[model samples]
Target: MRMYYPYVNAYRQNTPNDHNGSNQVMTVLGNGSVSVQPDVANVELGVITENVSLLEAQQANATTMNQVIEALLRFGVPRENIQTTSYTVNPRYDFVDGEQIFKGYQVSNMITVEITAIDQIGSILDAAVESGANQVNSIQFTVQNSDTYEQQALQEALANAYDKANAIATSMQVNLNPIPFRIEERTDTMPIPFSKLALSAEAGATPIEPGQIVIRATLEVKFRY
Candidate 1:
């Protein structure tokens, strides 16, 4: 008896039956991907303030961040959608003549805002910046309902695996089982971040383009022939 095992891209492996008597098994890997427009966006923006005194720096950062949040709320963003992601105060230092000199305290406050209306990302970013937001960190795009797309991708992957296995069996003149004895799914869904954006708070109505998001699924199937 003989067995055939196929890896990625339909690479075949042949083995003579020595162990397991006359049992013959075939293994193959399949991959599928689906791309769709993102439905949601998360924007990370904040304010940074520096002052000689730590208390002053903290107070300034708090005031600016409050203004930014209020602006976002007035622009139709729900209060619950805005959440603080990071808040830190660190001492600033400078090297003068091979000596470390204390400069001031730097306070940074960052918030993540979730926007369901994808078209309004540019306007919202403009609003935040106009209201004392100085630091624009990043933006991430994702789909709200990912389970549906994942299932579709999985189905496509299984179909692909079946096709490959059938082709191998036909070429080798052997009987192939239509049903796989084992199926393993490897799926990964992640939010795509748009980091190459040219951002300028001073520029009017910053242009933001949200690209398509891709969901991928991989499967390893084993069949008896």
Candidate 2:
């Protein structure tokens, strides 16, 4: 993250009347935002296997997860970008006539795949499901270089603050300093979620829309006249 320092002008000369001890300061709040399409997609997909025997369920889940990873690799995703997010083995049970009946063992293996190519998300989902991925957990779209956009937003916020302060000074018939003595930045970023995902292989090629992400910046500025 890049930090922005308070702006001070070297050419401005202060007189005795412009003493720092004077409480003649104007405070203003400014906001700025930028919207852009996300450059990266994170998809959480995995396999869930169930069997009467615990060993069989584990083996089945492992085999399916391996195949899914291989398919992702062949589809242009880097090996390092694919990571196992969770793996668990649990016993399945059912309530029959108020009696707990032991069903089987269920094994689930989930992995998160980072895709830099945003346009290939649909095809990637199809490939994963075809290769044995049965569960599609979530999909999130976000910017890869968020710092750059945040910096731009900060600059815009500062500009907005200066404009508001100058307008206020003009209305009060007082000279306003172009430079702000203090500035505080507050940034907020929210990732876009693609929640409507289908994991069935019969659904054919899935259509994915990354949409747009918004980067917002708020600044509190204090200026002296």
Candidate 3:
């Protein structure tokens, strides 16, 4: 049987001129999407410190980062979920009379923390800041059970393709087959992180909103009718 993919010419262009079974074949593409609320979050926070010496700069950075990690642990974040992502120490220079002069040294240490609790995101960020986090970098929210959503979308896409095939078979006055040869195309959805959140005495908790996550599925179905 010949298949009629939308992007490919099944009868007029590719098949032989004497091909007579083209009327029995039908191809369809279906797209499906579902919206799901995020269940987990990953937040990156860090501390930046500057000192006259590299040792002092690194020491200060480590001290602040340790305090931040302790605070997160106290807030119920697991030790395994917290990881050091970046650490750097650089020399600060001052240009005077076109000469490079060393002024001080600056150190930066960053860690990524995974938060499973959906509702405590804001309060946790606030707590980290209180524990000496000065450079708040990024916060990302996503669904923990992505497999479930993707399966649901695939089912929906299959159903949509079947419906379209049925419609085409009916219009062509042919008997539709029960099963079709289907090719599934998978698409992954990315989480759009919330805008920057800064700490302030007046702002009670770091306001955060985890928007909906969308998953999509596509299928190419070929039916013999």
Candidate number of the best TM-score: 2
Model 2 Cα displacement at 193 (Å)? 1.4
Superposed by TM-score, candidate 3 places the C-alpha of residue 188 at a distance from the truth, in angstroms, of 1.2
- Writing each residue's lDDT as its tens digit, candidate 1 over 61-124 gives 9998999999899888899999999998899999999999999999999999999889988998
lDDT of 2 by residue, 63-177 (tens): 8899999999998999999999999999999999999999999999989999998888888889899999988989988998898898788778878888898899899988776
TM-score of each: 0.87, 0.88, 0.79
User: Please, what is the whole-model Cα lDDT of each candidate in the order they appear?
Assistant: 0.83, 0.85, 0.77
Ranking under lDDT, best-scoring first?
Answer: 2, 1, 3
Residue 68 of model 2 has an lDDT of 93
Task: Name the runs in model 1 displaced over 4 angstroms.
Answer: 1-22, 196-198
Clashing pairs counted in every model: 0, 0, 0
Q: Ten-residue segment with the worst summed lDDT in candidate 2?
A: 10-19
State, as a TM-score between 0 and 1, how close model 1 is to the true structure: 0.87
Model 1 scores worst on lDDT over the 10 consecutive residues at 1-10
- Candidate 3 lDDT by residue in tens digits, 1-225: 122334322221232343345446677886788899988898888899998988888888888888889988998999999999998888999999999999899898888989998899888888888878987778887887798888788778777877888788789876666366445465566786765667753468766888888888777877666
- 1 against 2, candidate with superior TM-score: 2
